[model samples]
Target: MICYFSGTGNSMWVAQTVSERFRDNRLTDMADAVVSSNNLNFSLTEDERLGFVFPVHSWGIPWIVRKFINRMTIDNYSNQLIYCILTCGDDSGLTNKMLLKLFRRKGWQCRHIYSVQMPNTYVVFPGFDADPAELEQKKTAEAVPTLEKIMAAIVSDSPIDCYLQKGQQFLKSRIIYPLFCRFAMSSKPFRTTDKCIGCGVCVKNCPTHNIRLENGRPVWANNCTQCLSCLHRCPQTAIEYGKESIGKGRYYYGKRKDSQQ
Candidate 1:
C-alpha cells in the first residue's frame, strides 16, 4: 500500500511512480484519507510493503502528516517492509529522521528513506519566483530519470543512508516543534478577495477541507494543511496569503477540471 500527501502534485507524482513498480498496489490521497479518517480497509500481510510519500516543511514533516502517522493503527504486520520518500524544494535536512522516529513509535521497521528535490512551492520566502516553462522542463527532466533509479533501488532492496538521523532527533526534541507551532503556525492565513468566482475549487481541493464557501467566498478555517492548493488553483487570481503573493506564479497539475458545466 502506498499512501501519499502531495501539496502541488510533486509528491503525488513520486507516489504514482513508486506504486507503478509494484503489484496489487493501492494509492490513497492523504487528503481524502484524512477526510475519511484513514479508514483504508487493507490488511498488511507478511509479504506486503507499506510506503509513504509527502513533502517536507520546516525541515520536518508537515504537521498533518505527522498526525496521520501517529494516529494510524497497524498490528500484526511486523514482516512488512516500510519505506518513505520525501520531496523537497531544497535540503530536506532533518525531516527523514523525524519520520523514522514516528514510524518506530508505530512499531514499523523502516527499510529506507529517501529525498528528492522538486520545485520550491513554499512562497513564504522573499522575492520567490520561477519561470513556469523552465521549472516544468527541469522538473520533468530530473524526475523521470531519478524516479526510475529509485524504483530500481526499491526493487533490488538497496540500502540507504540514514542521512538526517541526528538532525531529525534534534529537531523533534521538546523545544523546536513546540516553538514553531506557537509562533509560525499561529500566524494569520491568507485572505480571499471578492473576485472569487464561487467555484468551490478551493473547498473541494483543500486536503484538510479547511476552506468553506461563505457569502460566495472561500473562508479558511484553522485546520488548513497550508498546501497552497486553494491559492494556486483560483482562476480569478484572487487568493493572497501574505500581502498578495506578488510575482509568484501559480501551478496546477493534470487537466483543470471544468467546473462551469
Candidate 2:
C-alpha cells in the first residue's frame, strides 16, 4: 500500500506513478484517512509492501501526515519492508530521520528512504517562490530518471537511503523545523482578494477540512497545515498568504501541463 498526503499534486503524482508500477497496490490519501475513521485501518497481504509518500513541509513531515500516523491502526504482524518517498522543493534536511522515529514507535522498520526534488511550492515566506518555467520544466524532466531508479531498487528490494539534496541535518531539522512547526502554521495569514468568486475550491481542497465558505467568502480555521493548496489551487488566483505572496506565482502541477512531461 502507498499512503500519501499531497497538497498540490506533486506527491500525488509520484504516488500514482509508483502505484502503477506494481500490481494490487492500494493508494490511500493520508489527508482523507485522518478525517474518515473507516479509512485508517489497514491489513496488508503477505506479499504487500508498505510505502509512505509525502511532501516535505518546513523541512519536516507535514502535520497532517503525522496526525494520520498517530491515529491509524495497522493490523500486520511480521516485519515487512517499508519505504518512503519524500517529495521536496529543494533540500529535505533530516526529515527522513524524523520519519524513522515515527515508524520506530510502531515497531516497524523503515528499510529504504528517498527524496526527490520537485518544483518549489512553498511561497508563504520571503525569498521563496515557485520555480521559473524553465527550472520547473527541468525538475520535472529530471525526476523521471530518479523515480525510475527508485522503482528499480524497490523492485529488487535493495536497501537504498539516497536522500539527495538533504541540507544541514542538525540545523534545519533539529533546530529550525521545530520552530517552524510551532509558529509558522497559522491560518490567520490567509485571505481572499477581490478575485475570489466563492467557487468552494479552497473549501473542498483543504486537507484538514479547515476551510469553510461563509457569505461568499472562504473562512480559515486555526488548524491549517500550511500546505499551500488553497493558495495554489485557487482558479481565480484569489487566495494569498499575507503580504509575502502578493506577487508570487502559484503552482499546483496540473496548472502547468508540462510538469507531466
Candidate 3:
C-alpha cells in the first residue's frame, strides 16, 4: 500500500505516479482517511508492502501526519519493509531523521526514506510565488531522473540510506520543528473575503474537516494543520490568512492547464 497526504497535489503526484508502476499496490490518502476517522489505526497484514508519502512541513512532518502515525495500530509490522517518501520544494531539513525517530517511538521499524523535490506550496504568506518558469523547468528536469531512481529502489526493495547532515538535521528537526508547532499552526487568521460565492470547495477539500461554511463564506476551526488546502483551492481565490495573503498568487499543483479552474 502506498498512502499519501497532499494539500496541493505534490505528494499526491508522487503517490499516484508510484501506484501506476505498481499496479497491484494500494494507493491510500491519509487526508481522506482522517476526514473519515480521527484515530487512524489500520489492520493491514505485515506481509504486504507499505509505503507513506507526504509533504514536509516546517522542516518536519506535517502535524496531522505525525498524529495519524502516532495513533495508528497496525496488526504486525515485522514483515513489512515500511518506507517513506517526503515531498518538498527544496531541502527536507532532516525531516527524514525526525520521522524515523517518531516511528521508532511508535515501535515501527522504517527501513528507507526518500525525498522528492516538488513544486513549493507554502504561498499563504506574503513574498512568495510559484516557482518561476525557468526554476520550475529546472526542478521538473531534475525530478524525472530522481523519481526514476526512487522507483527502482522501491521496486528492488533496496534499503537506501539518506544523506544525513547532522548539524543541519539537528537544527531543523529539533529547533525549527518545535517552533513551527508553537507558532505556525494557528488558524485564527483564516477567513474568506467578500468574493466568496457560498461554494463549499474549501470545506469539502479540507483534510482535517477544519473548515465550514457560515453565511456563505468559509470559517476555520482551531484544529487546522496549516495545510493551506482551503486557501489554494478556493476557485475565487477568496480565502485569506490575515492581511498579508490578500493579493498573493494562488497556485495549485497544475494550475496552468486546468481550464476548469
Candidate 4:
C-alpha cells in the first residue's frame, strides 16, 4: 500500500508514479480522512508491502504526518517492509533520522528511505518560497531522473544514504519546526480578494478542512497547517496571506495558472 499526503500536484504526482511501478499497489490518501475530520489513525492490511510518499515541510515531516504515525494502528505491521519517499523542495534536514524513530515506535522499520528534490512549494514565507523560471525548470528536469532512481531503490530494497542527504541542522529543524507549528499555523492572516468567485476550490483542497465557504466567501480557521493548498491552488488567485503576499507569485507545480474561473 502507498499512503501519501500531497498539498500541490508535486507530491500527488510522485505518489501516483510510484504506485504505477508496483503491482497490487493501492494508493491511499491520508488527507482524505484527515480533511474530512481530524481522525489521524488508519488501519493497515495485514502483511502487505508498505510505502509512504509525502512532501517535506520545513526540513521535517509535516505535523499531520507525525500525527498520523502516532495514531496509526495496524495488524501484523512487523512483516511489512516499509519504504519511505520524501519529495523535498530543497534539503531534507534529518527527516530520515526522525522517521527511523517514528517507525521504531510503531514496531516497524523502514527498509529503504529516499528523497526526491521536487519544485519548491512553501510560498507563504519570504525568501523561503518561490523560484525563478530557469531554476524552476532545472529542478523539475532533475526530478525526472531522481524519481527513477527512487523507484529502482525501493524495488530493489536498497537502503543507501540518498544523494540529497545533508546535515540535519538539528538546532534549526528540531527547534524551529515546532516553533513554526505553534505560532505560524494560524489561518487568521488569509484574505480573499474581490476576485474570489466562491467556486469552492479552496474548501475541496484544504487538508485540514480549515477552510470553508461561508456566505459565498472562504473562512479560515485557527487549525490551519499552513500547507498553502488553498492559496496555491486558488483558481482565481484570490487568496493571499496578508499584504505581503499581494504580489507574491502564486506557485503550484512550478507555474501560476490563469486566475479566471
Q: State the lDDT of candidate 2 residue by residue for 53-115, as single tens digits.
A: 999988888888888877667798477778899999889888878888988898888778898
Give the per-residue lDDT digits (tens) of candidate 1, residues 1-261.
888998777798788878877863687676667666646445787777788899877667788788777776666677687778888765676776678788777677887788876776776546655336576557656867776766667767895452323344465544565565556653265777678788898888788878888988888777776777777777787887876475687765442333423
Residue pairs clashing in model 1 are none
Which residue ranges in model 3 land beyond 4 Å of their true spot?
A: 125-127, 161-167
Clashing pairs in 2: none
lDDT string for model 3 (108-207, tens) is: 7876798877777787656765677567657666777787788788778886654323357777778978998889899998877789898999998888
Off by over 4 Å in 2: 258-261
Q: CA lDDT of each candidate?
A: 0.71, 0.86, 0.78, 0.77
TM-score, one value per model = 0.84, 0.94, 0.89, 0.90
User: What tens-digit string does per-residue lDDT give for candidate 4 at 1-261?
Assistant: 888888877788788888877764677777665555566444566666788888888778888777777776675555667888888877887788889999888788777888888777777777665677677778878888888887787777776666465675787579877788788877888999999999999998887777888999999887676778898889899998886576676667734333332
Error in Å for residue 99 of model 3: 1.2
Estimate the Cα RMSD of every predicted model relative to the unseen true structure. 4.0, 2.0, 2.5, 2.7
Better of 1 and 2 by lDDT: 2
Residue 173 of model 4 has an lDDT of 74
Candidate with top TM-score is 2
TM-score of candidate 4 to 2 decimals? 0.90
Model 2 TM-score relative to the real fold: 0.94
